[model samples]
Target: MLCIEVLVEEPSAEAALKSLLPKLLGSRARHKIINFGSKSKLLKVLGQRLAAYAARINKGENLRIIVLVDRDQDDCQDLKNKLEVIAVQAGLTTKSNPDAQGQFMVVNRIVIEELESWFIGDIQALRRSFSSLPSISPTSSPFRNPDNGGSWEALHRFLKKHGIYKSSYPKIEAARKIASQMNINENRSPSFQCFKAGIEALLSQENENLN
Candidate 1:
């Protein structure tokens, strides 16, 4: 199992992933994987970094492993399809499985941004605290007061609801708590029993796709 990582914004994200993913790698034998991405206003997002990342990964000497992606939309599947197209354009075979005779695990990205999904909660109510504050329009432009939906605000409600507000800050840090809950890497999280099964199903489907 080759391991590689890239970024989104905060360097702490990379630091956090380093701490998080290695433990998630489990018993797989680690192999060399290229790591690169830049953090800048116009360049931080994966949309801007795809070409550079694609170029780097195209030079693989062995079967490949994918670095993860963001949770902007339910588009991880779309990203995989795009990557397969890109790989085809580059004249390379894209292995679509994590465990196969030779296939490398090449697509591991998390897209669930809100923690409530795993917490068995609702969306409308989840963002109500921040969303109800005000309504800013496209007509407002830079003056359009954007609603704050930071983990800070989200966690406050979560802890308050769960009756954990009295404990400490840890009880209400939404992103931290979400990160703690989500594996991000596929190999972690004992709670994701179905997730593991889905990975197996994906591998099976990919094999059928190959055939």
Candidate 2:
């Protein structure tokens, strides 16, 4: 079995992943989710942690690491390149450079705008979480690209306008609620699909090795 170490940006992301992974990985999956307080903290210590992980890998430990961070308003390619550079600097392999067999150690993904975009990706999940959430066409402007504004704030406004959550967005609570209802294999967010694809690749590689 492969051990997965997921490094996330915030408590809300951690909560969401905790709820989603079991469904994604099944009852027998082996993984650990670590929240790094904030994105700043994560970027600060990511290299050091990757170095430690690289050392463990050298000792024949079967491990895979995933770093998930919110893209916010940063340039996506630039962020990914920075992450890839850090991983390589720490002596770890990345998807950008693989061996002849195409093996890599770290998978990095950015949540477009914010993790709440994931909930927005699945309108049915939003409706399930908040009964009063209006059924807008998935093809509509708001639903088309949930990353339009501060994704979380956009979600807050949507819910507020629809007579659901009247106050502020409850980050952790909302994550747990909406994530539990998310269809593991059927989200429309490109970033979410990127995340799922990375995990699926790792799991597939692990299974192949087991055989």
RMSD of every candidate to native, in Å, equals 11.1, 1.3
Candidate 2 per-residue lDDT, tens place, 28-84, comes to 458999999999999999999999999999999999899999998889899999999
TM-score of each: 0.41, 0.95
Candidates in order have lDDT scores of 0.38, 0.88
How much is 7 displaced in model 2, in angstroms? 0.2
lDDT of 1 by residue, 30-62 (tens): 433233432233223334344554566567522
What lDDT is reached at residue 153 by model 2? 85
Clashing pairs in 1: 66-106, 71-111
lDDT of 1 at 137: 33
- Clash pairs, model 2 backbone: none
Clashes found in each candidate (C-alpha, N, C closer than 3 A):
2, 0
